[model samples]
Target: MDAIVALHQRVSQSRLTAPAPDSIQLDLLMRSAARAADHGNLQPWRFLIIEGEGLIRLGQLFARVAAAKKPDITQAELDRFTAMPLRAPMIIVAIAKCQPHPKVPEIEQVIAAGAATQNILTASFALGLGAIWRSGEMAYDDTVRQAMGLSNNESLKEQILGFIYIGTPDADARPARQINPKDFFSTWTGE
Candidate 1:
């Protein structure tokens, strides 16, 4: 698919099914992700591929975290947290491996990691695969991060950017809505 077409029409596929992107497709997506722009050449991004039993363990970890917090969370609440990873056949946990850099700030590293994730999303669309970027409380929960083997700390530079779910869309994705660039663009004048 043409890059412009992919960029213009890419939409999040929330209801994904099995038959996730094959090895070749995954290779392409990873390559695309690696191409994301970075300042100071500090490629501060990494990914963890989770599927099969790994997904089950991830779900269990989420449940454990939730249960620890509330201690009285209902069964349904635990199930909901546990089922999150099962939403997709495959998930790539995008993490920012940010480190102290005199020339580059932590925010820039995080943005670069986000750009890498965007590349994966766009590439998935072009490859006829469905993808969604999902992150919420679990993503920021220190316990969850520790379960993922991330460094333990209140001010850790490394953090989870998102959990990118990729698979075949269960149904056709909604059409992309075109918004006028003029609405968001303007000429800046130094006054």
Candidate 2:
């Protein structure tokens, strides 16, 4: 697919299935992510690729976190949390590893990581694969961060931007929602 078309038409695929991207495709996705806009070249991001048994382990972690939060969590709720990671064959955990940079603030580094994630999503669409970026309470939980080997420190910011789920689309790609550029874009002038 043309790059422009991919950028314009990419849409999140919620219903995904196996098999996940092959090694070559995964490499392409990573390369694309590395090309995201980075101010001062502060490459403040890392990704964790999870698949196969790893997905099960991630699901377990999710369930564990949920149970810890609510001791009264029922079996059905635990099962729901456990099955979250099984929605896709593969998951790429995007982490923003923000470090102190004289030129780039922490927020810029985080945005760079987010751009990397967007690149991954666009590349997945271009490669004829399905993907969705997800984040919720689990993302901000310190336990989940520690489980992912990320720092839980309040000063040295390290955060999970999202969990990018990748696989074959269970259904056809939905049409991209149309929006008028005029609504969001306008000329800025000194008034």
Candidate 3:
């Protein structure tokens, strides 16, 4: 598929099924992510690929975090939390590994990571696979970060930019919403 077409038509697929992207498709996604614009040449992003048993571990971590917050949490609630990661066949946890840079602020570093995530989603569509970027409260929890081998220290940014769920689409992806660029953008001129 042409890059422009994919960029314009990409839509998040919420109901994904098994059969995750193969190695070749993943390579394309990774390569696309690597090209995200970075200020000061500081590539301040990293990804943790979770699949198979790794998804189980991630789900357990989510449930544990939930239980830790509410000691009386019910099994149903715990089960729900556990099933979150199972929504996708694979997950790519995008992490913003910010570093001190004279010219680049921490927010810029985070944006770089976000751009990489956008590339991942677009590339997934181009490959005829389904993907979605998601991050809820659990994503930013200190315990969750710790479980991922990250510290809660100030330096870590403490942001799980996204958990990119990837899998085969169970149905046709929703059509892109029509939005006129003219309404969103315009040239600036001093009047």
Candidate 4:
């Protein structure tokens, strides 16, 4: 598929699934991810590919974090949280490295990581795989960050950027997106 069409398809396929992306496909996707623009050539991004037993470990961590945060949560709820990793065969944990650079700002590094994530996502969609980027409390937890071999200051959580879940589609495609460029466009006319 052409780049434009593939990108559109990828944007529309931002959904999670259970089937995992193969090793070869993942390598290809990573290559695409690495091609993203990086200011100062810092390439301040890394990925931890989680699959098979790793998912089980993540699930356990998720359950622990959820339980600790909400003691009143029922076993069913905890189980649901634990089962989240099972929704996809593989997950790419996008980590942002914000080391200070002389000419590049921290935000630029973050944007580069975001671009890498988008590359992975677009490559996955072009390869006929379902993918989604997710991150919230679990990604910000100290214990979870430690498990992923990341250390951080008290104020910063080391920015997980995203969790890219990949798999084969198990259900019908989701609803098509309606794109209205006019609503998002702007003009430079000095008014």
Candidate 5:
């Protein structure tokens, strides 16, 4: 497939099915993720792949967090929270490791991580896999972060970037609304 078309077709997938991506596919995806552009060659991104029993554990953690925060949450809501990780056959937790570089600012390092994440999504799409990037309470919660062995210098406000779920689409994903380029473009003339 053409690179432009492959990139344009990449969409956030929320509905995925059984038979997670095989080891070979994962190897390719990881290699593709490593190809993301980085300033100063500081690869400040880390990916944690979670699936199988790990998904169940993640679901439980989400449920625990939800219940602790919202004691009055209904069983349905709890179930929903618990099942979030199970929605996809594979989930990659993307973390931004901030390593101070004299020549590279902290923000740039973080941006490199974000770029790596985009690469992961794009690669998944190119491989005919569905993908979605998600982050919420789990990414911010101290307890949840510890559960996943993620360290965040809260004082610095540095933490996990987000979660990228990848798998085969169980159902068709609704394409995002076409965006108008005009809304974001403006002529810049040095006067």
Candidate 6:
């Protein structure tokens, strides 16, 4: 698909199903992420690709975190948390590995990582795969960060930008909502 078309039409697919992207498509997705804009060439992004059993493990971790936060969490709530990662056949954990730099701030590094994730989303759409970028309280939890191998130490700050779920779109997937550029665009002029 044309880059412009993919950029314009890409929509989040929350109701994904099995049959994730094949190896070739996965390769393209990662490559697209590498093309994201980086300030000072910090290249401060890393991705953890999870599928099959790994998704189950991630779901379990999510449930654990939920239970820890709320000791009174019911069985059904725990089960719901455990099933979160099962919504898609694959998940890519997008991380921003921020490093100290004279010119580049931590926020820029995080934004770069977010752009990398956006690239993956657009590439997935172009490859005819469905994807959604998601993040909840678990994303900001320190325990979850450690579980994902991200350190919250003094020198280096690593953060989970989002969990990108990818797979085939369910048959009942909703259509993308129409957007008008005029509603969001504005011209700036010197007074």
lDDT leader:
2
- Report the lDDT tens digits of candidate 2 across residue range 1-191: 99999988999999999899999999999999999999999788999999999999999999999999999999999999999999999999999989887889999999999999999999999999999999999888889999999974655678999899999999999999998889989998989
- Lowest summed lDDT across 10 adjacent residues in model 3 is found at 150-159
Clashing pairs in 1: none
The CA-based lDDT of model 1 is what?
0.92
Which one is best on TM-score? 2
For model 1 the local lDDT of residue 175 reads: 98
**What lDDT does each candidate get?**
0.92, 0.94, 0.90, 0.82, 0.84, 0.92
Model 5: runs farther than 4 Å from truth? 153-158, 173-176
Cα miss at 33, model 2 (Å)? 0.3
Candidate 3 structure, TM-score to reference = 0.95
Stretches of candidate 1 off by over 4 Å are 152-156
* Model 2: how far residue 172 lies from native, Å: 0.3
| Model 5 steric clash pairs | none
- Give the clash count for each candidate: 0, 0, 0, 1, 0, 0
Model 6: lDDT equals: 0.92
Report per-prediction Cα RMSD to one decimal: 1.7, 1.2, 1.4, 2.5, 2.3, 1.3
| Weakest ten-residue segment in model 4 by summed lDDT | 9-18
User: What TM-score, computed on C-alpha atoms, does each candidate reach?
Assistant: 0.96, 0.97, 0.95, 0.90, 0.90, 0.95
In candidate 4, the residue pairs with backbone N, CA or C atoms under 3 Å apart (3 or more residues apart, or in different chains) clash, namely: 19-167
Worst ten in a row by lDDT for model 5? 150-159
lDDT of 1 by residue, 1-191 (tens): 99999999999999998998899999999999999999988888989999899999999999999999998899999999999999999999999988778899889999999999999999999999999999999989988787788863444567898899999999998999878999989999998
